[model samples]
Structure formats: structure tokens, C-alpha cells
Target chain A: MELFTPDSGLVIWMFISFAILFIILAVFAWPAIMKGIAERANFIDKGVEYAQEAKSQLDGAREEARGIIDEARRQQADILRDADKMKTRIVEEARVAAQTEASKVMDQAKESISQAQKEAEKNLRNEVSAFALEIAQKVVRNQLKDEKSQKELVETLMGDMK
Target chain B: MHQRLFRYMVVIMACMILPVFALRGEDLAGNSAAAHEEDKPIDVKEIIFEHLGDGYGWEVPFNHHKRIPLPVVVKGSDGKWHVFSSGKITDHQDYTEDGVTFRLAKEGEHKNKIVEVDALGNETRVTDMSVTKNVCAIFLTMVVIMGLCFWLKSWYKRNGYKVPRRGLGAFEALIEFVYNGVIKSTLKDKAEKFAPYLLTVFMFIFVLNIMGLMVVFPGGANVTGNIAVTLVLAIFTFCFTNFFGTKHYWKEIFWPDVPLWLKFPIPIMQLIEIFGMFTKPAALTVRLFANMMGGHMIVIVLTLLIFIFASFGPIVIGATSVVSVVFSVFMLLVDVLVSFIQAYVFTMLSTIFIALAQESGHEEKHEKKEDAGGGAKEAAAVTTL
Candidate 1:
């Protein structure tokens, strides 16, 4: 009945008890416990498979998005380049037309100026010649007025003229 | 028929020869003088030691009240001394063989002791000790069981079988049960590493405990009722706990930190905790040993009541026998439950102790984090107000 007695026989019995208990547990309870563990493992394995599938899908979507972005960028670059080329062509065409119109107007102005100058010059010459004939007739009339003296003067004038 | 006959003959011969061979080489020097004239024949239960007259020797005597083996010393035909006890023989022939000769005394006579002669041709009084038959039986049982387990395990492995069908299946199941219930419950991450020890401890205790039950039930054998067996097991646990215990565990036990106000009392608390550590395993040892021994004592006492009333009447004997049987059956059931529970408790406690020892630092870190979080929450509430 004493506690903590160093009874050697009890030691032997303890060993025996331990051995038998181990055997019983090993046989029956162990399998059930292992079944639980196996089920857990299967659950984890399924989770891992789902995660892998999700990862692969995400990667595929990312790749598709990247492809779309690249395509959009290429189209953008083409549109911008076309716009630049059209702007340059429009500006060059406008500059050429403006130059051509200005030159045509200048040529017309030069031709009209030359014609007007020639007419003005002819008129001036006729007017000056008439003026000069009138002056000369006036002088001749004055001199013939003195006709009486004119026969003699005419003779002198004809002589002087000769 | 010949083989059967040969086996019978062999058994008969063994029966005859075993006692004779066992009796041979026992030292009978001191007891022979006392046993010369006997009122009753002295039953020599055990022989402790033997020595030649030229040197010193000693022997201890015991009575055969219980069926356990008493330590025995013997000298073999090689003129050497040997000690037989605990199912093992330690040969001292290298030192004693040159100077001694040994022989068996008479068997039928009351003088069943070994006689040793020294180099001077003088008869020397030496002790004759022999290992007990029960001890030998227990030892043989252990070896056979272990061998069978190993063989089955190997065979299963070699055959590429998934699990054992019969005996091996039982063993694997027990292992897994301990692994999950005791090891996994007590140890979180490193259960597998500790599984073997836990399983071994559980199985060992359980088998022995059940053996104790068997001893009283039908084919009764008081194996676990013996103290020496329990002591060895306890010692094994003690050594294992100490050896595998983490440094942090020992530190916590010896130098635990307490609040500043309780600093003076910390030493006392630490002392108690240290004592607690020792007591845990000690409790394991005593709980198992007491339960087994208590059940056995009760059954024996109950059966003894029949003998006390033997002279009264047949009716009394019959009644007592019936009562004893009924009580013993009840006790057997209890013992069975105790066997499994004690094994589980021991393994679980040991695993928990190891786990605690190994992970105290982590627990402390977690606690500190919680405390800090609480403090931060309090500060945030104050600021919000």
C-alpha cells in the first residue's frame, strides 16, 4: 500500500503491460488513425492541384493581355506615322499652290504696265510733234502777213532758203 | 510416429536433465554443515555467489514464496566461475578458472548445492546460485516476440506489401495509433521523429500491463507485479526524458522568470517546478506499478478467503469461489482499461514534456507579440477618443 516503493517486480509488470498495450493499439486503433491521415493528405493534394490549375490559367490570361497590348501599340504607331505623312503632304501642296498663284498675278501686272507705257509714249510723241508744227505755222503766218514786203522778202527768203 | 516419439523422449529428457544441469556447480559450503541434520528438508531457492578458499566469496539465500528467480552463482566444467541472474550469465573464468574445480552435489538429498575445490586440494565453501525458471520464461518470451515482429516487418517489406494482414497488421495499427493520438496530439511538427520512441514506450507498457491482467484471469502469470520490471521501465523513461529534454526546458524549470513583485517567491516556485519535473515521470512509474500490483493483491486476497473457510463447509467454499470469480472478472475489465490508459497517459505526457521543452521560446515570442498588439490597440482607442 506504500507509495514510491522500489518494488522490482512492479517494474517487470510495467514492461509487460507496455508491450501488450502497444500490440493492441498497433493492431486496431492504428489503422483508423492512419486512415484519417491519408484522407487529410488527399485533401491537401487536391488543393495543390487546384492551385496549379489556377496559376496556369492566370499565366495564360496574362500572356493574352500582353499580346493584345502589343497589337494595340503596333496599330497606334502605324496610325501616328500615317498622320505625320499626311500632314507633311498637305503643307507642301498648299505651299506650291500659293507660290504659283502669286507668280501668275505678278506676270499679268508686268504685261499691262508695259502696254500702258508704250501707248503713253506714242501719245506723248504725237502731241509734241503737233505742238511743234503749230508753233512753226504760226511763225510762217506772221511772216506772210507782211506780203507786200513779202514778195521781196519771199525772194530773199527763197534765196536765203536756197 | 517415430518423430512424435522422439519429441516426447526429448521433452522427457529435457525435463530430467534441466534440473540436474541447473543444480550442478552450486556452492554448498556453508549450508551443508547446517543442513546435515534436518527437521525438515531445506529447499535451496537460490545460490548467490561462489569463491575458492584461496580468495573471498559470498552468497545470499532466499525462500521460494513467489515464483521469481533468485540470483545464482555457478562454476562450469571449464573450472571457471559464472554468475547467473536476470536471465544472463557473466563468466568470471578468466580469473578463477586456474585455481578452481566445480561439481554438482546430490540431487535427491536435501543437499542440492554446488561444491568447489581449490588448487591446494581443499574443499572450499562456495555459494550455488541459479537463475529462476520464471525469469528465463519471461526473457524467452520477449526475445521471441521481438524476433517475430522483426521477421514480419522484414517479410512485408521484401514482398512489397502495403500493410500486414494479421499480427503485423496489429503492430502497424498500434504504431499508427500512437503516432496519431499520442505523438501527433502532443507533438505538432516533429511527430514522426518521436513516433518510434512513443510507440515503443506505449507498446511496452501496454503488453506488460495486459500480462499482469492475464496473470490473475485464467492462465495467471504475475509478470508485471514484479517491482524489478517496473523499475527498469521507469529508469528508461527517466533517462530518455533527461537526455532528450531541450536546454530551454531545463532553464524554465530551474530559473523561471516571474513578475517583479514575485521575484522573492520565484526561487521557491522554481524549486517546486523542478521537483514537479521529476515527479511527473515518477508518477508515471508509480501509477502503473500501483494499479497493476493493487489489482493482483485484491484478486489474491479474494481467493485466499476460500482457503480460510475451507474447514467450515462446502457451501461456504462454493460461495467464496463464486464471489471471488465475479470480483476478479470485474477487476480484470478495469485492469484492461487501465493498461491501455496508463500506456497512453505515459506516452502523451512524455511527448508533451518534450514538445514543451523544445518550443518554449516560440511560445514566448508569440505571447510577446500578443501583448504588444494589445498595447497598440489600447493606444489607438485612446487617440480616437
Candidate 2:
């Protein structure tokens, strides 16, 4: 028996079959495959959009929080300044009122001491005048007595002479 | 202009060299003009099978055996018909007006022979023809299958049916399976570009593999069981691998920057790795070829046993036929799985090669590693200081 040999026709047929197979696949199968891929791409794009939106929202919230904190700090400082001003005004007013009250008290004390001194000087002078009058009265009485004595002595001399 | 010129010169050289080699080869084979005369009447047989004569030849699968035949039909000057088989041309002597002349060369009587003829009407006989029925059947089956596929495709297209149904539908499903499962997965970025070629490879191998398993059925050809087809496929892959390879891929293969100590060994290892790249596809070819061939061989061997034990009578033939049928069916199921697997394997490997060729490197990962290394080095230097 002779050995078997493949015909060139078979090889040609193989090539033809291969070509036909490729055409059929390109037409029918490719679309579905691409569709699935496109879907996956769309999913990724959506995910990225969501992430971006979230980041923007987070930044907006942070800015809002910062603004609130700054406003609160300003309000607190304003309150402290007003309280300090009110405290200083009250102290000044009190100091002025106290000074006026003290000066009034001092003037009243001086007036009372001057009135007492004047009254004491008048009383002392009157007392001294009464005493002087009393002494003068006593002296006049003595002197009159002495003058009588002298008159007596003079009278005795006169008697002796008579 | 220089490249074109060079290419043209190469083509011219090839064209010139090919014919010279062919003529030299023919002369060395001791082919003679007189021997050509003896092969005249056999020319009629040439018309029966197109592409099966003259210097043209193809390898065929035949019951676990592959054969190459170069059937020549030569007409003698004396107006006689002679059939010169591949190796045997002198078996049938030239019946001349003078007497019968015998050409003696090589071994074998009427079986497996070759014929040689010299000048001055001398002839040499060499028997070396091993044409079997199985081989003819295989050849015929291949032709018929190809014709059927063409007719069906054309018919379907002409009818203007929007969607494929029946035969076309099944074929379309197979295409989708390969495209989605193998090509898309392996060649993620460029699967679309490579889909058509990869799909073609998948379907071609798949159909041939399925046919290989159809031996139990009448009129089946085991084409995939032949190694030549697989070798051709492998060569295509090898060419594609190198042709489509990117600079980065080649850099990794050739000038890999391994550590200084490992650099010498690495190149040697890379040489092996480069060799391995070719061997991978070669192994793919050989594996598919061997598996298909082995399965067919087993089936043929089983069937042959029935004939060998003919002395056991009709009962034995019946029992053996039943067993053979059962085993062939089992093998057929396994072959179906293998058909898809082999197709997938080929596509997968090809896609990986393409992916490797097109890879640009993971820049993000590389940058991250560099930053880490720099940070560590800075810390170490600070500590030293």
C-alpha cells in the first residue's frame, strides 16, 4: 500500500474556512462584547463624578464651619470690650461721687470748728471783763479804805495840832 | 530607496536560488528523461485529484501514521503510461519495442519502493509506496468539509438573515465564547484590535480538533492529528510575538537590570527564557498535535485488533466492535472538551504575548516604590549624621 498524502486542496479549504469563520465572528459576536465593555467604562465615569461631587460638598461644609467660628469669636470679643467699658465708667462715676461727698464733709467740719472758736473767744472775753470788773471793784474798795486811813492819819495830825 | 532595493535584491536571489535548488534536487534524485516517459499513462490519474501531482506535495494523517506522497504521471516517448510513486518509479518496467528493461535500486519488492532511471535507457527499481485507504478518506473529507463551510456561509449571507440560526448560530456562539472569555481577559486594552485574528485562530483550531474526534463516524479526517498544521500555527505565533513586541518587553528580556552579582547568571537565564518563549508555542503545537494524534491512534489500534483476531469468528468481531464503539464515544467526549481547551489555550497564550508586547509598565507602582526608597534612605542618612 502507498503512504497517504494530503492534497493541496485541503490546505486551501482550511484557509477558506478560516476566513469565513472570521467574518461571521466580526459581524455577530463583536457588538455584545463591546457593549459590556462600554457599560464598565460608564460605571467608572459615574464613580469618578460622584467622588468629585462629594469632595466639593465637603469643602463647602468646612468653609461654612470656619465662618461660624470666626463670627462667634468676634461676638465674644465685642462682649468683653463692652463689659470693660461699662466697668471703667462705673468706677469713674463712683470715684467722682466719693470725692464730692468727702469735700462736703470737710467743709462742714471746718465751719463747726470756726463757730466753736468764735463762741469760746466771746465767752472768755466776757468772763475776763467780769473778773476785771470784780478786781477793780475790790481794788477801789481797798484804795478807798487806804485813802480813809490816810485821811485818818492826816486828821490825827490835825488833832494833835489843835 | 536602499531598503526597497535590498528587498528587491533578496527577492531576486530567492527566486533564482529556489529554482536552482529544485533542479539540483531533482537531478540528485536521479530523475531521468526516460523514466519520465514510462510515467505517461499514469497522467490520466492526475486529473482525478487536483493538487496531487508533479512536484507539489502535502502531509496526510493515516491511522496513527503520517505519509508524504509525490505522485507523478509521466508520458514516455514510446507512447506508454507509467505511474511513478513518490519513491518508486521503476516497478512497472518500460515495455519497449525491443524488450523489457528492469531498473534496480533500494529495497522492498512491490511495497514501499522508489524507481530510478539513468542515461542510455538504464533503469533502477526501488519499492517504497505506502498508500492507504484511510489517508485517501482523510483527504476527501477535508475537501468536502471546506466546500460545505463555504457554501453555508455564502448561503446564509445571501439570504439576508439578520441573525445567525442553526449552523451559523452555533459558530457565532463559539466566536463569542473565545472573544469574551479568552481574548478580552488576556489582552485587556487591545483585545478589540486583536479579536479578529484571535477569533480566527480559536475557531480554526476548534473545528479541526472536533473533526479529529469524529473518527468513529463515517468519512472523517483527522487533520489536527497531523503535526505540520500545528507547526505552521506555532510559527505564526512566534513571528507575531517578536513582531508586535514593544521596546519595554524586549528590554526586560534582553537587558534586564538584575543585581550586579546576578547580572551574569541572569543573562544566561534570560537566554534560556528567550528560548523558552519559542518553546512555549512549540509545546502548544506539539501538545495539541500529540493529543489528537494519540487519540486517533488508540481508536485505530482498537479497530485493528478486530481484524487481527478474525480467527475467533463473527462473535469476536461483534464484541470487539461494540467495545471499540464504546471506547471511541468516550474518547469523543474527552476530545470535545479538549477541542475547546486547546483552542482556549492557544488564544490565551497568544493574547498574553500581545499584552506583554503592548505593556507600558506600571508607572504609578514604580513611582511609589521610588518615593519609599528615597524616604528610607533619607532617614538612614539622618541617623548616620
Candidate 3:
């Protein structure tokens, strides 16, 4: 029978103790715990979002870097092509200048050689005239010295002239 | 695998049988020597009830006569409050102070309880507000609950939302299990509003249940098994359910949507609904009380089988003790599980009751649509109840 009875003192104690526990927990304990859980959840969520953003930015940067490398390669190819064209043009111009220089040297040398040949020919003519004149004078003097012989030689020359 | 399995079975059988034979030899000599003292037959019912009931003090292990005294606070017949150690009045001797005499009642309705006696030898109950064994156990439970609560609160304070590790982690898991698995799931958005009471009751009953299993010192008091304690807890649910009940909830109870014939002719639905309101808490009280009380009774009964079989000779006594010990051990393990279950069930039913009381017209319509979409479990629970 006592087992079935609800004692007044115990019921009162149960109510009082339970009420105190509830008040203490609701006011002091549960809020802080729930807040902490929410905050940690928020922190982790933000961390994941930031990581995703960083990854996207890194991907974009990598793409831009690849583009820049390609552009630099294209520019390098253009510069090399321009350098090749310039080298060919310079070589062609040098060859033309060299040919023109060689022709000019040949023409000047030919003109100088013609002038030296004319001078040498003129000197030889003069020398040969002078030598002939000297020989004629010697021959006249010898003939006078031998008048007799000279007279007979002059008759022979006249007959020969007729 | 078969051989190993056979070996284990044989070993277990040997273990069970070995204890019987070993205890047989000792009990044979003991029983013969104590045969003349068999006039006092074992009162299995009394022993079981004593174990299931509360006391003025805690029973000492291996000794029934000795106990650890607790304070007994009672109002005397002289209209004065008296406080003394329960040990003073336990010896069937009267303790008198200020011309008022009190003794622990030995028989009748107030048997084994502190009472006052006049000169004519008429025993009357004074306002007994003693911190009896159950009350002491309640205090111990409170201390444990507070320690756990503050421990959890401190973790949240220091670490700010980090799940605790080790023992505290296990405590957190239980908290979350009750909160999420029962309270939040049933009450949904309203869980937080009633969460304090719900969580407190859950922890309180749970701690009391576990302490009841210890059978010594801080445990052994069947606080939850006492109907008085369960009645208080159930009353709390009743208050929460009704006080916080919605207008629609009250409407559904008194002026239900049954046909006019049912409402006017016999008021059948109204009568049933009103009866249901009281029965809900009653069921809660009896469910928890009976479960805990029964678990304790079964264990005590099993252990009593040894003494009950004493007249059958030493072999029977020894064999019964072995079987009784094994069964009681198994029952205790089961009771541990029952403790969790009963606690869980109490909290869950309370949550559902509160949730039902919180119901409005809008949710009913929403639930109807939900039922079409395969969400009829909550509805079914309500209907079944």
C-alpha cells in the first residue's frame, strides 16, 4: 500500500529539485552550448567556401599564365622571323655593294693601264726618230770624205732615181 | 569453428556445474549445523518487497542488520519539527525528546516508517518529511546530474562548440541522442521551448535508473521504482501538456469533430478525449514505475530462490543459488538496457504529448497532405494512442 502511495514530501522535493535543474540549465547552460555548435558549424562552412574560391582563383591564374606563355612564344617566333628577314636583306645588300665595288676597281685599273700603254708607245716613237736622225748625219759625213766615191755613188743614185 | 564452439559450451557448462558442486559441499555442512535454526522460514515476499521499497538508511553490503543512517525530518505531534539521525529510532526502541516519543513503526500500514506514539500506545504518523533512502538517492542523482550539466557547460564555455572527448563525449552523445532522437524529432520547432524540462527529466530518470542498479551505497534505492517519484514526473508532463496546450488542442478534446450524433447523443468522443487527457500521464507514470519496479522485483526473486529451496536440502539450495545467480546477473544486464529504454520511452512519450498539445489547425491540414506523401507515422502514433 505504501508502495502505491505518493508521499507529499518526495513529490515536493521532486518538483523543487526538477525546477531548479531546469532553470539552471535553460538559463545558464544550453544556450552557450547551442551557440558554440552553431558558430563552429558556421566557421567550417565559411572555410569550405573560401577554399573553393581560392581554388577557382588559382585555376584562373593558371589559365592566364598559360595564355601569357603562348603569347610570348608567338612574339618570340615573330621576332625570329623578322631577324631572319633582316639578315637576308643585309646579305643581299652587302653582295650588291661588293659587286659594284669590284666593277669600279676593274674599270679604273683598265683606264690606268690604257694611259700607261699610250705613254710607253709615244716614248718608243720618239726614241726611234732620234736614233734615225743621228744615223743619217754620220752617213753624209763619210760620203763627203770620199768625194770620188761619193760622185760615182751620186751618179748611181741619179740613175737609180731615173 | 565447430570444435571451438563445442569447447566454449563445454567450458561454460563446466563453469555453471562446478559452482553448484563447490557450493554444495559448503552448504551441506552449513545446512546440517543450522538445521535447528530453520524455524524462521525465509519470507520471499517480504524480502522482495523490502528490497523494492525505500528505507530510512542504506543497507550495508553482506549485512542486512547494519545500515548507513540518513537524517529523518518529521513534524512531531507537539507541533514542533524534529530532526535526528534515522539510526536512533531503528532499534524498536522509542526515542523521546521534549516529552514526545517516536519509534520506527514495526507493523501495520505505517510499518517500518517513523511514527509517533502517545502514552496509550496508539501509533500515529507525524508529518514524515525525512530524507529517507530514496530521498538521499534523489540527492545523489541531483549531484550527478549537476556535475554532468556543468561539465558539459564548461566544455562549451572553454572550447565553444567542440564535441568533447572520452567520458564527456559519451555524455554528449547521450544528450544529443535524447535531444535529437526524441525531443527534437517529435516536437520539431517547439523542442527548444520544452527542451529544458524534457532534457532534465530524461537525465534525472536515467541517472536514477542507473543508480538503482548499483545495489550498494550510492545506488540500491529504487527511486524511479517508487510510484511517488513517477507520479511527480508524470504530473510535470501533464502540466506541460495542458498548460501549454493550444486552443485547437482543447477544442479537439472537448468539442471534437465527430458527428453531431456522437457529440450530442452520448458525448462519446468528448468523454473519451477527457479520459484520454488523464490517462496519458497515468500511463506514463505506471509504465515507468512498473518497468523499474518489475526489473528490481525479478532480480530479488531470483536471488530469493536459493533460500526458498533450502528445505529441499543442500544440493537443491546450492543448485538453485547457482541458477538464481546466473539468472539474476542476466536480468540485471537486461535491467540496464531497460533503464535506458524506460528513460527514452518516458522522454519520448512526454515529447509526443507536448507536441500533440502544441498542435494547431494548420498543422493538422499539413499533416493530412503529408500523410498522402507517406508521412503518416506521427499521425498513426496519435491515432493509436
Candidate 4:
């Protein structure tokens, strides 16, 4: 029976102690602790948000960087292809110009050579005619002394003409 | 290697229990009918009850006759207050002062309590407001809690809400665990409003329960096992649950959304709701008290087994002592676990109760009608606590 009994002294003390503890803690401790905890929680939340924002911004920057690099590579490829085509065309044009100049030089050289050859042939023929005329004159003079030789030369020339 | 270690530990434990066995053998030798008052047969019931109950003084270890007395405050029959050390009355002697006599009653209904006697030799109770063992223990518990709470506060104050290091960090973890796990999850937005009381109760009960496990100074008082203490805690829960309860809570209790027949005529649901209200706190009170008291009682009973086996000679006494020590040690460890659990359960239940009261049924009505069943289920969950 005594075991079941609730002592007033202990009850009063317990109530007083509990109330005092609650009051003291509620006023001095709980609010501070709770406020500190809540503030920390809020701080962590903001930190996470900031980190995520920074990460997304970094990702965007990286994407932009990738885009810039791709554009530069594309421009470089186009410029390289254009430079290769220009090099090919320029080489082909130079080769064609050299071939035309060589051909024109060769034609001019052939014309000059033919002209020289013609001149030489003409001179040779004139010389030959002249020599023949002179030879005939000398023969006529020498043969005047001899009427038979002159007469024989004239008859041979007539027979050749017939 | 582990097995060897274990054998060594058992041997060491047996060595420790040997002295206790020798002491009990001496005690059993005086168990004859003509023995002295201190050598009387062991009263297991008295021992268990005494250990479970609050005392006017803290019992000294290994010395049943003497105790460290506390101050006794009582009002005499002469309508005046008397203050004295409890040792004066607990020494099996009557204390007389200013024409009034007070004595601690023995072998009667008022046994183990201070009673006032008059010229007619009739014993009547005094207004005892002593700072007994339990009260002192409460003060000790309060100081410890204050130390821990203020330590945490100072840590936060200095560090600006950062997680504290080491033991203080563990303490913070416990606080956060209870607050976030039980209170905040259950009470939702209203958690902050009632967190102070709930957190305090949790710490109060937890520290008291752990402190009760100690057999030495500052730890031996069974404060939590007392009915009065648990009742006060329960009453606080009841007050908080009812006083801060929302309008919807009261409406649900008096006029629930049950069938019309259950609400009217017989008023079956209403009665059950009212009954459920008291039952919540009642259950809280008894559950904590019984669990703690039972834990303490089992340990004491296990210890008494050595004395019970003393008549069987040294062999039986030695065997019983070893078994008893091992079991009691195990039981004490279990009690430590129970202490934390009971504290957690008490706080969890209180949170649920407050959460139940904080529910606003308007949401259920404004939303789909099917959710109303969920509300009733929630109420049922609270009653199960």
C-alpha cells in the first residue's frame, strides 16, 4: 500500500523542480538552441542552393565554351579547306601559263629558222645564175678568136631548149 | 583468443562474487530465531519495495542500518512547522520538541513514514514535505540537465550554430533526433510551439531513468519509478494536449464524423472519445512507472537469490552468487536500454498526442472526401498509444 502511495512532499518537489527546469530551459536554453539549430539549417539550405546555382552557372559556361570551341574548329576546317583548294588552283594555273609561254617561244623559234633557211636558199640561187652568166661571157670572148667554138656553144644551147 | 578472454572474464566475475557470497554466508548464519535485529531473516518483499520506493535518506552501500539522511519538513499536530534531519526519526527513536512527538511508523499502515503522536497514543500523519531521497535526486537530475543544456547553449553561443564536437555533438544529435524524428515529424508546423515542453520532458525522464540505475550516491534514488512523478509528467502532457488543442480537435471529440446513430441517442462515439482522452495520459503514467519499477525490482530480486540460497552451504551460495551477479549485471544493462527507450516512447507518444490535437479537419473536407478516413485512422493511432 505504501508502495502505491504518492508522497505530497515528493510531488511538490517534483512539480517545483520540473517547473523551474522548464522555465529556466525555455527562457535561457531552448530558444537559443532551437534558434541556433534553425539558423544552421537555413544556412545549409542557402549554401546548397548557392552551390547548385554556381554549378549550373559553371555548366552553362562550360557549354558556351564547348560551343565556342566547336565554332572555332569549324572555321578552321573551312579555312584549311579553302587554303587547300586555292593552293591546287594556283599550282594548276602556273603550270598552264608555263606551258603556253613555252609553246609560243617554240613557234617563234621555228618561224625565225624558216625565214633564215629561205634567205640562204635565195642567195645561193642568185649566186649560181650570176656565175653561169660570167662563165658564158668569158667563153664568148675566148671563142671570138675561134669562130667554130662560138658557133658550137650556140647550137648546143638551141638543142637543149628544144 | 576471444573464448579464452571470455573464460578469464567469467573467472574474474566469479572472484568478485566470492566476497558477496561470504558476506551472505555470514548473514545466513544469524538467520536463527534468536538472532539480533540486524540479523533477522531476509524479507525479499521489503527489500524490493524499499528499493523501488522513495526514501527519507539515501541508503549507504553494504550497510542496511545507516543512511545519509536528508532534511525532513513536516507540520506537527500543533499547527506549526518542524524542520529536522530525517536521521533523528529514522534511527528507530521518537523525536520530541515543543510539546509535539514525531516518529517513523513501523509495522503499520503508515510504516516507513513520519507520524505524529499525542497524549492519547494515537498515531496520525504529519504534513511531510521532506527533501527526501527522491527530491534530492530530482535536484541532482536538474543540475545535470542544466549543465548539459547550458553546455550545449554555450557551445552554440560560441560557435554560432555549428555542429559541436565530441560528446556535446552526440548530445546535439540526440536532441535533433528526438526533435526531428518525433516532434517535428508528428506535430509538423506546431512542433516549434510545443518543442520546449516535449524536449524538456524527454531529457527529464531520460536522465532520471539513467540516474536510477546507479547504486551509489547521486544515482540510486528511484525517482522515475514513483507514481507521483509519472503522474505529474502525464498531467503536463494532458494539459498541453487539451489546452493548445485546435477547434477542430474539440469538435472531433464531442461530435465526431461518425454515423449519426453513434453520435446521437446513445452517444457511443462521444463517450468513447471522452474516455480516450483520459486514457492517453493514464496510459502514459502507468507505462513509464511500471517499466522502470519492474526493471529495478528484477535486479533486486536477482541479488536476493544469493541470500535465499545461503542455507544450502558454501557451494550453493557460490553458484547462486555467480549466476545472480551475472543476471543482475545483464538486467542492469537492459534497464539502461529501457531507460532510453521509455524516454523515447514517452516523447514520441506526447508528440503524437499534440499532433492529433493540432490536426485541422478543414483540409479533409476541402479536399477529397476519401481522405476523411485517413483522419479517423490517425485518431485511432493516437488511442493505441
Top-TM-score structure, candidate number: 4
Alpha-carbon runs more than 4 Å astray in model 2: A1-162, B1-162, B215-219, B364-385
Query: Tens-digit lDDT track for model 4 on A35-139?
Result: 888899999999999999999999999999999999999999999999999999999999899889998898898888888888887787777778777887777
True contacts kept of each: 0.19, 0.09, 0.64, 0.79
TM of each candidate vs. truth: 0.47, 0.46, 0.75, 0.85
Q: Ten-residue segment with the worst summed lDDT in candidate 4 chain A? A: A136-145
> Model 4 TM-score?
0.85
Better of 2 and 4 by DockQ: 4
Interface RMSD of each: 9.3, 9.3, 1.7, 1.0
Docking class of 2: incorrect
Q: Score the docking of each candidate (DockQ).
A: 0.07, 0.04, 0.39, 0.69
lDDT of 1 by residue, A73-97 (tens): 9999999999999899888888888
User: By summed lDDT, which 10 consecutive residues of candidate 1 chain B come out lowest?
Assistant: B47-56
Docking class of 1: incorrect
Ranking of models by DockQ: 4, 3, 1, 2
Alpha-carbon shift of residue A128 in model 4 (angstroms): 4.8
Q: Model 3 Cα displacement at B249 (Å)?
A: 1.6
Better candidate by lDDT, 2 or 3 = 3
Is 2 or 3 the stronger prediction by DockQ? 3
